[model samples]
Target: WVQKSLDVTFEEAVALRQAYLHRYGTTLGGLTAEHQVDVDDYLAFVHDIPIERYVRPNPRLAAMLSAIPLCKAVFTNATSEHAWRVLRALDVADRLEWVVGIREVDFNNKPRLEAYQRLLAFLHAQGPDCILVEDRVVNLRPGKRLGMTTVLVDATPEEEVDFAVGDVLEVGPLVARLLEAQND
Candidate 1:
């Protein structure tokens, strides 16, 4: 349905879903209240997207993540099953120490403080020392608010994230520098 709506970018779609949560206490509730759209239909439409085309494994990314001794986790708005599928396709499934998706966390998605809290709780982490790498500025806000070191991959000028870079492959060197600085 979002693809049919020319006005809806991926970011907009996410915002719409979030709006649903804000208005009706859940995305499905908002869909039902506003559009009369069935929850199942919405789920099917979201799950039907062609994700493989958009994601690919960067061996350099895997190597860098693996080299870091700190625990790593994925905190995504996608369902746990979808997250697993994407990670498996990228061949980095095993590298992740944890994954907290919508279903696993009772459908509380990001920019919700609850989602970040749940993720940290699940990981048994003390605070926001772990770095969060994301492609979207909207997604980074909650993580940033939670005190996590935020890195925006390919951020636009409007985002003004803590660190911005063009490619994930470059993260390895940057992480190395951060580690060196920490040791100093």
Candidate 2:
């Protein structure tokens, strides 16, 4: 669906996808900027998948999110519709204060400076006080550069991140400690 939407062969799509990420931060950004692809059509086509089949509801995750006392929101490269579906499926939609997706920032995705700036502006937030927890190390770079504390939710440790955890279970305590330190 993505290849057809982009009007490119599979191999061409793969190459262009990489090139797009390198240049425009997201395939949607590059396609719209360079090829004039319709943003709505592209997003709908690419995200038309069985989300429920992949995402199972987790009560533990919901409980963990409820335990955290900070204002929470989702910042994602996916469309808001997609984000909502996944969040709902996970049973954590209500816990979040905001959902910032690619559509919200005019198709700009993460690792892009403008997208980060727009997100912080939209949230009325400052960079230094924000904490970005993400699985991708590449995505954490921009947040770190903007002075946001970066948390890497990956298996291995990253020197660039302020904190690294193997999974979501470790996040609550680490965040609590950080918040406590700030209070002191």
Window of ten residues with lowest summed lDDT in model 2: 1-10
* Superposition TM-score, candidate 1 onto the true structure: 0.72
The local lDDT score (0 to 100) that residue 30 gets in candidate 2 is 84
Per-residue C-alpha lDDT of model 1 across residues 1-184, encoded as one tens digit per residue? 6434435778887888788767645565456556655445556677776668888876766787787776778887766777877887787888887788766666566766787788888778755577878887777887888887778887554445678778887666777788899999
lDDT value, residue 135 of candidate 2: 92
Once fitted onto the true fold, the runs of candidate 2 whose alpha carbons sit more than 4 angstroms away are: none
lDDT score for candidate 1 against the true structure: 0.72
Q: What is the overall TM-score of model 2 with all chains considered together?
A: 0.91
The clash count of every prediction, one per candidate, is: 0, 0
Cα lDDT of model 2 by residue, 6-47, tens digit: 677999989998998888777877887788677787777789
Please list the C-alpha lDDT of all candidates, in the order they appear.
0.72, 0.86
